[model samples]
Target: METVTRRRTVFDLFVIDADDTLWESALYFERAEEDFILLTRSLGFDSPSVRRLVHSRDIERLALTGYGARPYLGTLRAVLDELCPRRPSWADSAFAEISRALLEHPVILLPGARQSLEWLRERDLPMIVYTMGEQDHQLSKFSRSGLSDLVEECVVVERKTPEALADLLSSKGVEPSRSLVIGNSPRSDVNPALKVGASAILCSRERLWQAEKEDILDPGRVHHLETLSDLPSLLSFLEAAPDSASRDL
Candidate 1:
C-alpha cells in the first residue's frame, strides 16, 4: 500500500487516544516491567527468560483478564509467585510495592500534548478522548491528565474495535472522510478507524505493548509522527489545504 499523506485535513471531529500517545503511560509500565524482571531474575530466571515469560503470560492473560494496569500487574505477580514462590525475593514486600506503583503511577502529559490540545481548543475544534480499559481507571487517568477540561467528553470502553469506531462516528454524524483518530496503538487506534474509513495519525512510541503492534493497512488514510508536538502543525497544514490531493508518505 502507498503511504499517503492525508488527502485533506479539514476534519469535523478528532478522536484521540489517552495512553502513551498523549502521556507518559507505557514508560511507567516499562519501569514496572523492569522492576519485576529484576525481582524475578533475583529468584533465578535470566533477564531474557523473565522478559519472555512475562510477555507471554501478559498476552495470554489479556484474553481472560482484559486490559488494565491492575490486571497487568497481577499477571506479573502471578507469574512470579507461580515460578518462584519459594524464592526469598518472592516474599519481599518490595515486590508488592512495585506492583502498586504500576497501578497508581502518576499521569504526566507527553511533551507538547497540553499545548497541542490548547491549540486545537483555541481553533474551536471538536475533540473527544476515546480510550479503552477499565472505566474508573481510564477516567482517573483522564482526570489527572490535565486534558479532561479540553476534550468534549471522555468515552471509555472495554475495547477500541472497528465496530466501536463506526458506532462513534455514526452517532456523532461525523463523516469518515472528515474525521481523524490519533493514537499510539495501531491495533486499537489506527486500524479500527481506517477500517471504518476515517483517517488516522499514529503517534509512535518507543515501547509499545506487543499486542498493539500491527501493520498499517490503509496507508492512504494512515500516517505516522514522532510525537504529539508535531500534531498541531500537521492539523493546521491539512485543514488549511482541505482541497489538497494525497501525497506519498
Candidate 2:
C-alpha cells in the first residue's frame, strides 16, 4: 500500500465501482475476445492482426456506443463484418455463443470483496455501488452480485465523468472531502474522484481493460491497494490516527 498526505477526516460515504472492481467482469470479456479471435483464425485471418483490430475498434466505439456487453459485441460484429463480408452460417452461431457467455456470465466476486464490504457495513459506513454502462445490463449484474443488501443504493450512468461524480455527491448530500471513491479504473474511478475533490482508493487488478487505462490525475489524493481486503485495515488506521502524517505502508 502507498499513502500520500495525511488529513484529519473520516469518510462519510463510500462510492464503490461495480463490474471489475467487485466481481469478475473483464475476464469474461477477454474470453469473448479470445473466442472471436479463434473464430477469425478458423476463417483464415491472421490471429495477431484480428486481435489488434478488435482492440482498436473497441476503444474507438466507446464515444459512439458507450460501454456494455451488447455494445462490445457490436464492436466485435463490426470487426467480423469488415474482416469477412461473406461470413459463414457457423459464424452466426459462434457469435450467439459468445454473446450468451458475455451477457450471462456469473457474478463471481473478487477475493475479500464481500468481507471488506461487510466490515464497512458493520461500522455503519454508507456505501453506494456506482457504475457506468447500459442501465438494465449494469443493474442486472448489481442485482446478481449479492452485494445489493450491503450497499445503500446502486447507481448506473452511461458514462462516469467529473460532472457526474459531482452531481452524485451533491444529490447524496455528501461533501467531497468526506467521501471516498473506490474502484479499479484510473480513467473512470480515480481521475473522476480527484476532479471532484474526493479521496480515491485504486484497487489495482492484474487484467485491466484497455479503455480504462489512464494516468492518475492527482496521486497525492489517491490510495493504491493491492486488493479489497486491504481496505478495512487502511480505513481503520486512518480513523485511529486522523492527524498522523501520511507515510508509505
Candidate 3:
C-alpha cells in the first residue's frame, strides 16, 4: 500500500478570531471580575481601586502569562493577595467559584455567526479560526462552539503577531493578498493583517480589553463592520464591484 497526502486547500483564506469575535467571551470575564470586585469590597477595599489595580496587573502579567482564562484568574488571585496579605478562610473557595464559572461558561455564539459562516461555507470559502490562548482551553471552547464543521481548521497560538500570521498563510500556501483577517482587536487582528498585506475587517465591540486597544496602523486598508451578519453582504459587494472601486471600500 502507498500513502497519499491530500494537498491543503487554498483560496482567499478567511482568518477569523474566536473569543469576543465569534462568541461571548469577554462577558464572562467581565462577570468574573465583577464577582472578584464584590468579594474584595467585602474585605474593605474600594471597588474602583481594586478594579484599577486588577486592570493594570492584568496587562502587566501578559508578558509572562500570555492570554487565557487561567492566567487571567491568576492575575486576580495575585491582586487579592497583594491587597489582603492575611488569607481569609473563605477566600479560596469563593475565588475558585469565580474561576470555575468563567472556565465552564457556555459557548454562546455571536449574532449571525452561524449564518455568516454557513454563507461562506456554501460559497466554498476557506476559513480558519485563528485565535491565541492556551491550546487545550481554546480547543475545548472551539469544540463546544458548534462551529467546527463549518471551518476548515482552528489554530490556537500564544499570541497573534505579524510573523505568526505570515507563517499561517505560508503553511496553507495562501498568498497574503488573497487573505482576509477578521476580528475586533486593532492591536492583534487589524495591525497584523496590515503588516502581512492582507485585507482586514474590524468587527468593533463596545467593551474591548485595554491590552487589545491600539490605533490602527492604516485605517484606510481596513473595513469596519458592526456584526458578523454584515460579512456576507460585504463580500458580495466586493465581489460584484470593480477592483478599483472595491479598493477604496
lDDT of 2: 0.89
Model 3 ranges with Cα > 4 A deviation: 1-11, 245-249
Highest-scoring model, lDDT: 3
How high is the lDDT of residue 66 in model 1? 84
lDDT of 1 by residue, 88-176 (tens): 75456878899778878999888878988999899888899999889998888888887878885999888899999899988999887
| Alpha carbon deviation, residue 78, candidate 1 (Å) | 2.0
Off by over 4 Å in 1: 1-9, 86-92, 242-249
Better of 1 and 3 by TM-score: 3
lDDT of 2 by residue, 1-249 (tens): 566465444677899998888998999999999999999999999999999999899889989998889999999999999999998899889989999999999999998899999998998878899999989888889889888888868999899999999999999999886788999999999999888878899999989998899999878778899989999889888877634322212
Model 3 worst lDDT run, 10 consecutive residues: 2-11
Query: Against the true structure, what is each candidate's TM-score?
Result: 0.88, 0.93, 0.93
Model 2, 115: alpha-carbon shift in Å?
Answer: 0.9
Instruction: Report the Cα lDDT for residue 226, model 3.
Output: 97
Pairs of residues at least 3 apart in sequence or in different chains that clash in candidate 1: none
What's model 2's lDDT at 37? Answer: 95
Candidate 2 residue 3 C-alpha distance from true site, Å: 26
